[model samples]
Target chain A: MRDLSLHIIDIVQNSVRADASLVNLTIEISGEVLIIRIGDNGCGMTAETLQKVTDPFYTTRTTRKVGLGLPFFKQSAEQSGGELIIESEVGVGTVVTATLGLHHLDRPPMGDLSETVSLVMSGNPQVDIVFTCKDDKNEFTLVTTEVKEILGDLDISMPKVTRFLREMIEENLIELKLKIE
Target chain B: MTKVKSLDDLKKMREQLQSQVSLRVNSETPEKMVQVKVSMATCGIASGAKEIMNLFVNELDRRAIDAVITQTGCMGYCFAEPTIEVTIPGKEPVVFGYVNAQKANEIIEQYVVAGNLVDGIIPANYETVKDQKNK
Candidate 1:
């Protein structure tokens, strides 16, 4: 993943693949640290699989031999003087947390997050994804469940709905621009 | 944050805007709408697939083209990063590579809208898992 947003997208895809109906993704920037967490109620890994998830060579998917998603995200965080952690149970769920030094030179930019959210939603309309981005000065949260309620059985991935979701995300995140500077 | 007071208020608003919203209850039927799948794996994102996906969505809306856009995992074309598969009604799916915003625009204007094939069509050498299943 080139940016933090893309990293989030990669990790969330794992949850979707795990048969998770809900995924909660959080991105927080506080002081000098940037933090990301993805929690999912999915068919979580056994302790054995969780132990090796960070290994670039280990993958649960049979279609591929190497699963680089977690390893790449771990590398990105660790390169910025931070750490990645995974907590999972066999049938309960899993949560992945990564912290990065925000000001570190190696930290990739926080790329197009609205696009990231839209892509995830478009790809998994049946799943509920709750995304929250918080900084010291501002915070924005979007729950697809709520959006669905507003939409009333109209698919969220429909062109107008997607357009609305993209604009809603972008419009909310725009409040954080002044805070970023 | 304070747009609607309650569920009833939101529902009222939804009813007001429902006329403008097209209802496509099923996104799976390719015969009903143009089906587009953008590869969104890590490599794809690193290669600007995110931007291309957004371009397709926004441009399709601007053109009022009824298309179902989706994001999918890598199609084992890491070398051909930023690839997208477009399936028009009654047509075989075509995968296009190296799709930036410009190429995506060309795809929309030429291939998707006009039914005229443009450049950047990668040979559909690999079969998707879904394709294999249907076969």
Candidate 2:
């Protein structure tokens, strides 16, 4: 909502609630465009649910009547001179891709992305998340499975682990710098 | 710039913690320990629950408390954004409302450590789905 990372966190929560064991988020940038693509190996939706997911008023969650995650993401992309696309199949998975203008003023900043990715890991420790970003020259990726392999039976949700994870991600992202400008 | 992080670095870090008990936290009976669950719905996230979650995780670890901090969905207390449910073993769970950084600190110090009741405690005035199932 307030930032692109927040929207990302929200969308990933949907995948988590759907029991996704794997989630992949990729950010690709060209000259003037940036893409946020999130793919989840969660329980895919029925055609009925997919039809209403972007409606802002229809939600599978019984906790409340309104679901604004997708709608908000779509709006954020379009406001920045881009588009949002969601593709899914029953019993398979779902992928949400939002492309926006890198120079657009309305596009939200990629706020605290390391924290966002870390929080996602903190909450769903068992779920493996692969985060990747690329420009023409720089590329960075964080794969939880590889981290888990190294840690070997340690809980990823441990406070020290999360802190270290966030720091590593932050430094890598900063090193890459994401500026194809 | 700092050295770019790689798995090799984490491998070194793991050796230190692997020797500690933090690795075996859940394996040895979790229900006996404290459980702190922060509401993480869209409303809660927008209201700063993520920061609260980090505080609980880091501060609890700092104070050497053996509590499990986790994230949960909305607790039907939408009006009181940024809520959390704290459950100490052998005690009924209590949901606290409007939890900010200072309040979270008070919780860790007073309620969590000293076992004293604090303000802003939201009564379980209604039954949740899990509660109904148990009944």
Candidate 3:
């Protein structure tokens, strides 16, 4: 992936395909580190599967021999002088926490997180995604359920709502002293 | 700096959108509506499937098309990294590859809305027949 947001969405797609009803993602910048945590309530993974998911050549896709999402994400973090961790239980769920040096020279930009979040929601409106990002003094959160409540009978995936939400996220990130890459 | 939006702002948008927005997703009979499923696997993502997905969602909504847009896992067509499966109700699903924003728009306007065939179709909709024969 070219950017962190692409990696984020790729991982979220895994959760979605695993039939996750809810996914929680958080991005926090503290000191010189940026931490991203993605937790999902989905089909989960077995010990064997978890062990294999991070291997560069390990893949669940029968069509190809390699699955690059987790490996690339791990590489992205490590290259940025950080690390990646994953905890999963079969029939339970999975949580991935990756950290990267905020000022690392090789770190990819944050990319368009608003686009990532909105596309996931619009395509899988039945799933609830909670996104939170913070930078020391400032914090912002977008809970799909909360938005859905306020929206009443409307779909959050609607073009106008999606545009509005995108702007809202953009402004919040800017407020938190971060810019979309 | 402009204020970061809160739910209150969204509430206001909802009020205005109530008049303009279509409850199209809810009003349409799901079984009869068009289903656009974009492959969102690692290969697809690397090739910009997410942007293509966004285009499909917003464009389909804007065109007043009552369609269901979803993201699916790899269809075992790694060669066609960024592929999409479009299913118009009562018809078989067709897989299209190398889709970008332009292709998405064309799919919506011609193939999706007008039900006319377009280029880039993978022709594997008949793969089920091959599978059956193998069995």
Candidate 4:
């Protein structure tokens, strides 16, 4: 993946592919910790699927099955002196959390998060995404509901929609960073 | 650190510096400025544009090339993402796609400096603006 945000997008895609109707993504960056939690109201995986999710070689989709997204995320988190935890209940839902030591030299850069949110929103216009980003000084949240209202029936794939999403994320992050400083 | 009073002050200072720098570096000088645009759109980011953009900025700065790098929104070619548009002022702008760090380096060395086209160009049909209206 390109960076932490892109990796999050990849994992969230797995959730979308699982037919999730609601996906909640939270990113918390405070002190020396960067934590990301993604929960989806999708068909929860079975024990077999959960066990093989991080195997890097098993997938249920008809698409290319060499699954590497989960493993990569797990490896990245651990390498940064953190951990990846997953919980699922069959017929209920699934939640994946990845924590990284923000101060660790091995930790990958946060990358371009604005693009990540835009891509996910554009690709899965039907699914709802609640994205939250928090630092010690500030917090920001965006719900697909607000966006949909702002862009009525307009194709999310349109350049204008993508630009709006990117600007929203970037402007919020800038404000947050300024508050921290 | 002292903060600028207003944007107007910043603009004035920028203009002053611009003039001085222009005088210092004439067009006849061998050191030509290179401008690189990274496609940081949704599609490009999914295809690893951020990494490639960072690689370009870091490598060019480290090498001390007279370059300035920035990002732009989507160019409408989602399939060939991680696209990069390079402009060596006075020459035509070229767009390259599917860029990684390695490909970014090649573009800087081969295309930016040596004036050659690399692989992974999206066909003209997919270009966002049909004509060079902005240019």
Scored by DockQ, the top model is: 3
Local accuracy of candidate 4 as per-residue lDDT tens digits, B22-115: 5645542312566676665445666887567656655664564555455565565556778887778677677887787788888878877688
| Candidate achieving higher TM-score, 1 or 3 | 3
Query: Model 2, range B1-135, lDDT digits (tens) per residue?
Result: 558777788899888876665454535344756878888878888898888988987897797666656677777677788999999878999999999999999998999889999999987667655466567
Question: Lowest lDDT 10-mer window, candidate 2 chain A?
Answer: A172-181
Q: Candidate 1: list runs displaced more than 4 Å.
A: A62-64, A136-138, A176-181, B1-31, B119-135
Q: Deviation in angstroms for B30 in model 2? A: 4.4
Enumerate residue pairs that collide in model 2: none
Point out the worst 10-residue segment of candidate 4 chain B by lDDT. Answer: B2-11
User: Ten residues in a row with the worst lDDT in model 4 chain A?
Assistant: A151-160
lDDT for residue A7 in candidate 3, whole number 0-100: 91
What does the TM-score come to for chain B in model 2? 0.77
Model 4 TM-score (2 dp) = 0.59
lDDT of 1 by residue, A1-181 (tens): 6678888887887887788999999888888998889999999998788889888889765445778889999999999999999999978899999999988999888877777787788667778999888988787777888878777655556565576676667766775651221
Q: Candidate 4 residues A1-181, lDDT tens each?
A: 5468767767777687677899999988868888999999999999878888888788564323456678889999999999999999887889999999988989888776876676566556668899898987788888877666544433343333444566667776776672121
Residues A4-109 of candidate 3: C-alpha lDDT, one tens digit per residue? 9889888988898778899998998889999999999999999899999989899875556888999999999999999999999877789999999999999989
TM for every model, in the order presented, reads 0.82, 0.89, 0.87, 0.59
Cα RMSD for predicted model 4:
12.3
Model 1 quality (TM-score): 0.82
DockQ for candidate 4: 0.05
